[model samples]
Target: MFKLKRKIMSKLYTDIFDLATAKVYAVGRRSVWRDYFDLYFILKNNYIGLDESLLMTETRYGSVFSQKLFMEQLAYFGDIKDFSIEYGLGQKKIDLDEVKSYLLKVVKNYSQSHV
Candidate 1:
């Protein structure tokens, strides 16, 4: 069972790395009672936060919104994957194609604004 799980995770990581618009920097596993993976990616100038950070479980279930924005507080924060895991909150599964589309849109918008 553990071997099968590892195989699935390897495939998922490869699929994420193959995305053209986003440059993946690191992929690592973290455990705090349960195991989860964190993928660090670079899209244009964004780093460590926003869409650049992704956290998901071994079964690949997590949030579509990687970051949280609070207008009243004028603050931004990383979405806690632990809550999602605990409460089964993120029903929408992670989709690589959708991620690619979103990253491409960000790149296009950034380029246009700067030029």
Candidate 2:
């Protein structure tokens, strides 16, 4: 009876999926993004989900924000920042204001929703 109870309880432990679920989110690099606002916009608005879809899996963990994931998240929100507003065009040089505006918006949104 004791052995049976122990086996049953142990079987209920949830490590495999629990760990994987816990590892889904990655922390953002605010300083780096703040310093390079334009680059940040390009990355956040265009690159978030692509990288996460590519990199995330049952056995993988990401320590920092991914290039693709960041952009994807940014694109989700359409703020059109300072750098981007001035230089917003397809395949052309990226705008600095656009990046700054987009980064601030995404980061703020992320913080509010996440909390």
Candidate 3:
């Protein structure tokens, strides 16, 4: 039981970080739509602060995360529109454009503050 509890705790910590930190980092390097959706959901739900999330990401990944690259990826969603994936929050459906616009706003705010 102690071993099982430790395993669960380890996974829980990983999930908590992955929810925002890993997703945000992945968005900069890949066009995975799930990364964007997860980020939108995390931010909209107040799961974590963006600055804190980035800090955790940097802690985990060191200097691999570039703020410039992340901001650029967040702003560019042209290719994402061509790809489709089912998305929703609970029973309600979510639109891709809405996610894009919301994240764009977040990127804008983050950029302005960091600059």
Candidate 4:
């Protein structure tokens, strides 16, 4: 009976650890949308004046879906910086007041239309 109990407890612990590890992995992973936004910002900055080849290297992970979303946002915002405003500026390396103003107008228009 004791041996059976020990085996059951061990299985339970193993299951719990598996769940915890999965959660940890999920938390550490960046969503594809976030990756697209990072790439967009990098491109929008003219690759920070870096060589185009280097910029291409940075965008190596971009998939078809990410590219499509990036272009859609570009069309909607008319500028990459303005689209970045919607994602919050915590990750942004530069601040452009004009972009922020434009983002405000876009958000206002969107809100009004949805109402």
Candidate 5:
């Protein structure tokens, strides 16, 4: 039972890490604004590095993950229009433009260093 419990706990931690990493990597690939919002907070909290997140995302998504498309998507956010905003619990509201600006800057910095 002890060994089984340990295995379960280890898997749980790995799953949690993978989920968080995937969320961070989902920023550019997903169309929903919440993806970007979640990434803003994830990055704000320094949960994971962009490259590490991408690697984990690749593990989770296999070849379906596209770095080229992800970079392209990160470079733009014109599709997300202004809309009603809501935050859960203690979270505070943030402007859509602010989120976009933050993400764009992140991508720009990442691009500069990676290139």
Candidate 6:
């Protein structure tokens, strides 16, 4: 049981990350989106808390990584496996291409030093 669970992160965390952190400020808040489908990328490779693992947060805000910078770091994990855009009540079209590869890489690279 422990070994099985160890390899799995959890869909629950993915949902929270998408709901709480998925947004773009490249221009403004109105344009950014965090739809449900996009959570797959974050969940698949465990990027939910990559910044914390990497110790990339800024001292002033006490945040390991910003939304934009996070995705920037997500490029190292692998490649764009899958993606989708959702539109509905409280839903926005989220993109998930290439995020898994980058995030998995971050976890592998950083989890070691932190532990």
- What TM-score against the true fold does each predicted structure earn? 0.25, 0.32, 0.78, 0.26, 0.73, 0.25
lDDT of 5: 0.73
If ranked by lDDT, best first, what sequence of candidates would result?
3, 5, 2, 6, 4, 1
Tens-digit per-residue lDDT, 1-115, candidate 5: 9999999999976765676666655754666667677777666667666777777877878787787777777667777664565778997788778877888888899889988
Clashes of 6: 9
**Whose lDDT is higher: candidate 1's or candidate 4's?**
4
Q: What digit string (tens of lDDT, one per residue) describes model 4 on residues 1-115?
A: 9999999989976654443333222222433323334333443444331133223323543442242232234234332332233545575454545444443454455456546
**How does residue 79 of candidate 2 score in lDDT?**
35
Q: Give a tens-digit lDDT track for model 1, residues 1-115.
A: 9999999988875655443112221112222211221221333324233232333221232432222211111111133234223325764454444443554465455446546
**Could you give candidate 2's per-residue lDDT for residues 1-115 as a string of tens digits?**
9999888766643442232233232212232222244335334655333233324432354445354454354444333232223344665665555654765666566566656
Clashes of each: 0, 21, 0, 0, 0, 9
Model 6: worst 10 consecutive residues (lDDT sum): 24-33
Predicted structure 2: lDDT? 0.43
Local distance difference test values of all predictions, in order: 0.33, 0.43, 0.83, 0.39, 0.73, 0.41
TM-score leaderboard ranking: 3, 5, 2, 4, 1, 6
Highest TM-score: which candidate? 3
Q: Write the per-residue lDDT of candidate 3 for residues 28-92, one digit (tens) a residue.
A: 89888888888888888877878888888888888888867887997898766444567555657
Q: Model 1's lDDT to the true fold?
A: 0.33
lDDT of 6 by residue, 53-100 (tens): 223233323443364454443433233333434557885444354444
Candidate 2: stretches off by over 4 Å: 1-47, 50-90
